[model samples]
Every structure is written in C-alpha cells, then in structure tokens.
Target: MAAGGSRPEPFVVSSVEKVHRVMSWLKEIFGSQSLPPFEKNSETFDLLYTLAEYSEERERDASVLIEDMKERAAKYDAEAEYLQSILTETFDLSPSVLSEEGSAHLKTLVDTAMILDTKDTSLASLFSAISDRSLELLAAETKNKELELNLLEVRNKLTATLALENQLRMDLKKAEKDLEVEEAKAHFRLQNLQFLKHKSEDISIRIKSAEEKLIAIGLQESLMHEPLMKLSQKLAEVQEETVQVKKKLECYFNLPTSLPLARVKIEEAKRELNALEEKVSMRIEEMTDDFLELERL
Candidate 1:
C-alpha cells in the first residue's frame, strides 16, 4: 500500500498449517468425522511458559549438582591417593624372614654357650651379662611380632575401606551421567514448549486480523460474499481443530513430571553418600593413628 514498496503478506500461522496437514492426513486415512474439542488447546499459553521456566530451573539445578559431585569426587580421589601413599610409606608389606625365626636360632646358640660357660668361673660373670642381653633381645622380638600383627589388621581394614570408597565413587559417576541425560531432555522440552507458545501467538493474531477484514467487507456490502464467508468459516474451523490437535498431541507426548521426585531421591542419596564418606574419613583417621603408633614402636 506504499509507493515503491511491497505490501506486507498476510500472516500465516504454523498452527493452521499443522491442523491442515493433520486433518488432511486423517481424512485420507479415515472418513470425514467430527472431532472433539481439546480443552488444553484453549488453555492459556502461560502454562507452557511456566513449564518452560520450571524445566530451565531444573536443568540449572542438575548442572549445579553435577558440578558439586565432580568436585567432591575429585576431593575424595585425592584423599584416597594420599591415604594409599601414607600406607605404603608407613608399612613395609614385603615378604621377609620373621624376627622370631632368627631370634630362635640365636637363643639356641646362647643356650649352648651357657652350658660351656658353667665349666669355668672366669666366664661366669660374662655369661650372666650375655644371658641378660639374650632375654632382652627375645622380649624385643616378641613385642615386634605383636606390632606386626596389629599392622596387618590395620592394613586389612584400610583395604576394605578403600574398596568401599571406590564403589561410592562409581555410584556418584553413574548419578552424574543420569543427571546429564535428564538435563538434556529438560532443555529440549523447554525449547519445544517455547516454540509452541510462539506459534500459538502468531496464529491468534492471524485469526483476529482475518476476522476483522471479513467483518468490514461484509458490513460495507450489507451482505457477506459467499466465497469469503465460506473461507472465513473454514478458517475458524481450522483454528479450533488446530487447538484440539495441539492439545491431543501434547497429551500424547507428555514429558514425565518427575523432576521434584527425582530431586527428593537425589537428596536422599546425597545424605546417605555423605554419611558413608564420613565413616570412611573416620576409618582413615584411625589408620593414620595406627601408622603413627607403629612409627613410635
């Protein structure tokens, strides 16, 4: 309507296109039949917008959770490595001759010498000192054997604790992967809902503009043009049908509304995991104490 310019094209709605395609396809497959109104289609777009926002928030929360788990996992991994290094440094867990065996051989030699020393008073005092030294060495050897056994017990407990920690780490990794998948799904759904809302707005505007044009033309002529009237009626029908189809499709593809449930479950899991981590920490501390005692011995 302006000089040297093209007139704006009539706004075509995607909802109308969707209805036309669905109706035509259905009609071809089956006979023409009346379809019921889908209430959700007539429902306000606010619901979709709200759901989109909720999904976005959930996605954000999941991302945060994933980051937190990664941080915790890294921390625990370092701690486990440190504990392992401490264990290796503190305990000499290699195969070697036991002190008891060597001490037994030394005791036999000392006993033979004691019998020989009884033949002369000159070696009597020297034999007494040797006897005392031999007894002291035997006592030290017995104490060393006990300490070795204790160290063995502590090492066994630490190994078991480390295994449990590794299992927890694996579980956390699986949970992280699951959260990532859920986040992707939520993001996809959010985009789809937003798109639908936008299409609905565009369709509504087009319907209003068409209706106004029809009304003006009919008023000016004091009678509706038959073809225009038919077209208007068809458009109205298409609009309604589109809404119903949209609702039905939405219902068919309903996204699972288990975000809150999942959150609750994840929180419960986190609490349990935290408790297990604390237990492992306590065990590590105990092992550290034992290692310190072994050093003193």
Candidate 2:
C-alpha cells in the first residue's frame, strides 16, 4: 500500500518565495538598473533549481512507494480471502462467514497501506511512514496467525462434541436393546407360570378322584396322601414363580424412563453445538463488514 498521498512540493514553493523575497530585498538595496550583476547571483538560482528538482524527486519516490504498498496490500488481502475460502470448504463452514473472518485479519494491513505522508512531504518522513506500515503489517500477520489457531481450536472442539454425541446415541440404542431382552424374558417366565398353574389344578382333581377310589376299594391311604402332598407343594412353587416374574417385569418396564434422560442429554449437546455455530457465524459477519470498511480506507 501507498505510505501517503501526493502532496504539493514544499521546496518548490519555498524556492519561489525565497526568489521573490531576494528580488524585493535587492530592489530595496539598489534601483532596478543599478542591481547586482546577474553573474554574481546565478549560483543562488542554480541552487533553487536543484532544490526544486530534489523536492520533486522525493515526492515522486514517496508516491511510488505508496502505490507499491497499496498493490502489496491488495494482493495479500486477496490471498488471505482465497485461503480462508479453502479452509472453510475443508471445514464445512458457510463461505461468507469464513470469508469475512479472513478479511477481518487483513484489515490492519489494508489500513496501513492507506497511510500517506501528505503533510510532512519529505523523503525521510515518507520512509519512516512506510516503515511504520511495514511494522503494522507484521503485527497484523501475527494476529492473523493467532486467529487461525483459535479457529482450529474451535473446529477441534466441535469434532470432539460430535463424537461424544455419536457415542451417546449408540449407548442409548444398546440400552433399548437390553430393556427389550429383559421384557422378553419376563414375558416368557409369566407364560410358564400360568401353564404350570393350569397343570397343578388338573393334578388336584386327579388326587381327589384317587382318594374316592382308595376309600371304595379299601387301598392303603399312604399312597393317596403322598401324591396329594406333592401336588400341593408344586402348586405353591408355581405361585412363588408368578410373584417373582411380576417383580422382574415391573423392573424392566421402568427401564424406559432412563432412556428419556439419555435422549435429553444428547439434545442438550446438540443445542450447545448449534449455539456455538451461530455465535461464530454472527461474529464473523460483523467482523467482516467492519474489516471491509477499513480496507476501503
């Protein structure tokens, strides 16, 4: 970028003023025809001409440096934007948002390029001014690197959160599968108990018939007593099994409640990720607009 704008030559103006003042002084000292010889004063006029040329050359050099600076600033800005676009594409961000973020980093360089030594129109001052702009560019470049590192950090964080989200989802699915298996087991146990209860009722009827037969035929009572006692004990065991099955089924039925909590955590994570993305986008947009204005300067 240009260090400064073109300015009126100070030497040229002062030289003219000096010549006018000398003539006025000479006219006061001597009448027009009796003025000092031209040969005696030629050297002074030569010096004035030299000063004018020197001033012109200095101004031209400053102008050229300023133009060169402007070109360099523009090229750097373009390259910064191009690199930002590539990074955005690789990272899966909106182009406008990333582009603006990149431009924000170049704002300082752009502003520095627009600096001009219009007021102090001297080579030394112009050079100093250009040097200051170079310093500003260096600082801006440093800040740009910092910004890139920060962006990378954010991307890494996002990636980690996404991975966590996937893991959570897989856990939820596994939980669901486990609950289903428990439910199926509970259902089978309940069915088995009901079938056993039906069989026990039939055994009770057979034991009653065996008792009537034994009384009519005068058979020993011990045989009837053993079978009846065994049938009663089996019936008691089936009832106990039914109770245990109900308890297990109830426990499995409550498993679904935990699922909702797990799902809620995943949803919370998703919301956080979305909010982060929105914040980044909004900040980039604002910075981009501000930087663009600075570039125009």
Candidate 3:
C-alpha cells in the first residue's frame, strides 16, 4: 500500500450488484413479476444490466410522449367545445335547426372531401370539378366494359370459327382419302374389264377359225357339238360289240366235244346277239331322226 500510493476505484460494481440492478429494472418494467432464472456469470450480469438500462430509457421517453399527447388532447377538446358553442349561438346550427336537405348537402360535401383526400370543403368550385370528373370517369368505365364484352364475344366467335375450320379441314382430308380409294378401285375394275374384253375377243376369233376349218372339211358347223358327240359315242359302242363277237367265235372254235352244253351256251349267246341288234337298230333310228332335224334347221 506504500510503494506508489495508488488508490483503488471507489464505485466498482460486482457481478452480484449488476444482477441486482437488472432485477430492479425488470421489476419496474414488469410490475414486480417473478423473474425467470438465468446463469449468474459476470458476462450475463453485464449484458442484462445494459439491456435493462436501454429499456428504462425507452420507457421514460414513452411516458413523456404520453403526457404530451394527453395535454394536446385536452386542449383540442376544449377548442371543439368552444367552436360548438359558437356554432349554436351565432349560426343556430344544430341537428334540430338543420333542415334535412341541408344535412344531406353537408354529408355530400363531407363525402366529396374524403374522395378528394382533403379536409377543406369550403371550395364550391372544387366540388363541381370533382363531380364532373366523377361523371366522366363513370362514362369511361361503362364504355370500357362494353368494349370488353364485345371483345369477348368476338373472341368466342373466332374460337368457334376456328373449330369449324378444323372440322372442315378434317372432313376434306377424309373425303380426299375416300376419293383416292374409289379412284384406285375404279382403275382396277377398268383394267379387269379390259382384260376380260380382250379374252372374249380372242375366244371369238378362235371359234370363228375353228368354224372356217370345219367348213373347209365339208362338215357343217352344227355337227361339231351335239351331233358329233352322239356319232362318236355310237362308233365306240360298235367297236366294243365287234370285239365281243370275235371273242365268242374264238370260244366256239376252241370247244372240245360237249355239244349239249355248247348248244345251251350258244342259245344264250344268240339271245344276247338279238338284244344287241335291237339296241343298234333303235340307236340308228334315233340318229336318223337327229339328222332330219338338223337338215330342217
């Protein structure tokens, strides 16, 4: 203590003192409410104390502002009462004294003032200008609405027309496709008809050539069909009968004595020969009738 005779600071704040000061500030701000627990360190105490000081300063400023506002409000109220008394005594202006029309006009003026964003309703010229401007604005709005409706209708019609155009385009495409298919079918049928016509002409030429050849051989063209067929069948049957007769003659020549059995077999053969002769005569008669009919034709 005697080396340099330096003295320690007299009003040094401990962490506990700072914490107490913070608690007192909190009580003043919050009406003595229980404070929440917090860490009791030097840093914590210092921070809390700084915050408490700031809050106390703000509270003081707010209280001063409130007092000034109350004084102004009291002054304004007194002025309003004085003005009301003057209005009643000098102009006789009151709810009972004002006519309904005057009240309505006053309300209109007040509303006009509000719309114009001003408190001055003493300018008659300003109210007239505002009323004219409002009328113009209303007319403009109505015209704009009508134009919008017309535009909407035009758009709807355009949409419908576009849709119809698309449908027609599709139908046209389909029709073109159908026409192409039909044209192809017609072309194919034309080709088939031409081929058939050519084939028929070739067959006719062949038939004509065949008829010419038959005429050169001195045969009637009519003999080439039914009559020729009948003659060929009859010639075949005669050849078969001749072969059977040769076979019977050979059997008769090769017979060993057995005359009685040979006679019985010969009788059966004779009956078969008679039957074949009768059939041949009938065929000849039929051929003669056919030849006569052909001559007549």
Candidate 4:
C-alpha cells in the first residue's frame, strides 16, 4: 500500500514534475526559506503552473526594459564621446583640461538648449530671458493657487453664513407666528376684560336705579335687608316653638279616647292569671298522689 501510494498516475507525475520546476524557479526569485512545502495535488499543480507562466511573462517584460535602458545608455555614452572629441579638436581643450567654471557654463548652455528644444548655444541670452519669464509664470501660478484657496475659504464662509441666515429667517418667521398668536390671545383677553367692565357698570347702574326707586317709595335702605332678615328668622323660631306646643296638646287631648282600651287590656290580663292558677293546683295534686304511692311501697 505504501509503494502504491508513493507511485502516482502518469498525468499526476508529469504535473508534479512541472510543479517542481516552478518551485525551483520561485526559490531562485524568493529564497527557499520564504516558500512553503510544495503540495502534490491537481489544484496545487495548476496553481504552480499558472504562477510559473506569469513569472516568465514578467521576466520577459523586465528583459525588454533592460534592453531599452542599455540602448539609451549606449547612445548617451556615444554622445559624450562625440562631445569630448569636439571640445578637444575645436577648442583645443580636453574635458579633463577644462576648468570647473567652463564645464558648469557649458552644462548650463546645453541644459538651456535642451529646455528650449534647440541646438543653438548662441541663444543663451534668450534662454536666460525665457527662464525669467518662466520664473514669473511660476510665481503667478503660485499666487493663483493662493487666491483659489482664499476664494474657497470665502465661499465656505459665505455658505455657512447663508445657512445661518436661512435658519435665522426661519426662526424669525416662527417667532412672528408665535407673536401673532400671543397678540391674538392678548386681544381676546382685553376684549373679555372690556366686556366684563361694561357688564359690571350695567349691574352697578341697575342697582343704583333700584336703590333710587326704593328711596322714592320712602322705604329706608336698612329696612329692605337687615330688618326683613331679622323678622324672617324670628318668624321661623316662633313656628318651631308652636309645632312643639301643638304636639303636647294633641297627646293630652287623646288620653280620654285611650282609657277604655287600657281597661279592656287590664281585664284580659286578670282572666289569663286565673287560668294559670288553676293549672298550678292541678299539677300539685298529681305530684302529691305520686309521693303517697311511693310511701306505701
């Protein structure tokens, strides 16, 4: 079973070999210690195969980039040699014999020619003037950026101010509505106060007229209230006392009619007493006979 397990199918063996090659390549790129143990399965083999193909593609791209850089370097080297020859032949000075100041001046002139897209070193003065214009343009651009920033800040502040103004307007409207409601309530209350005042004045007028009429009839004002009230209280007290006296008189008048009923009740009580006395004598004679029989025994 171990031998059979160790041996895999032909396709699996081929896939395993391919995965091993990919693993070796990966180890070269990212050291063996960085990679995990290779898994022997169809899925793992497929993944390793795909990774190998992708790595080859990236390697090809890197080779092309390296070639391009090498070409550029070679071209730059040739240009440098040509420039050195020109300096040695035309100026009778090798690059090694040129002074630091002259070298710096030549480099600046070359840089300026490159910037202006021209090969004319004679236009150095024009390049200087153009450089000044570029400096001014850069300064203008920087100032423009600052102005844009300030404008943005101002716009943000204006937006906030507008929002606050809108909120204040809404609050003002709400306050106005509340004020109107309060004013309406106050007006209603004032009208009610005025109505009450008029009603009280009318009542006062009616009371004054009634008092005048009473005076014209020769009746004293004090007699209309306090004296009448006192008379009414006295009359109620006299009526209560009369009712008590009448009750006592009625009880005395009913006594003659109740006497015959009282005498008949007394006669019925005497007859009940005589019947009780005869029943007691009969119970005593029966008890004496029972006692004499017991003595004879």
Indicate which candidate wins on lDDT.
3
Model-by-model lDDT, in order?
0.63, 0.68, 0.79, 0.73
| CA displacement after TM-score superposition, residue 62 of candidate 4 (Å) | 2.1
- lDDT by residue (13-93, candidate 1, tens digit) is 465554555445445545767654434351333344344446668989999999997997696568656745665667742
How well is each residue in 20-62 modelled by candidate 2, as lDDT tens digits? 7566555654676677566536568656456655766898999
- On the 0 to 100 scale, the lDDT of residue 16 in model 2 is 60
lDDT of 4 at 262: 55
lDDT score for candidate 2 against the true structure: 0.68
lDDT of 4 by residue, 1-297 (tens): 685577665754476578788778778878746876666778877787778879889999999999997997696678778878887889888857878998898788778666665434555656776887799899999999999999999999999999999999999999999999999999999999999999999998887887678768765554444455665586567556555655544544445645887556555554654554465556446546644643453
Q: What's the lDDT for candidate 4?
A: 0.73
Find the 10 residues in a row with the least total lDDT in model 4: 248-257
Q: Tell me, what's the RMSD of every candidate?
A: 58.9, 43.1, 25.0, 29.6
Candidates in order, TM-scores: namely 0.31, 0.36, 0.35, 0.39
Model 1 lowest lDDT segment of ten: 219-228
User: Candidate 3: where is the Cα deviation over 4 Å?
Assistant: 1-125, 224-297
Better of 1 and 2 by lDDT: 2
Candidate 2 has a TM-score of: 0.36
Give the runs in model 4 whose Cα sits over 4 Å from its true position: 1-22, 37-52, 109-297
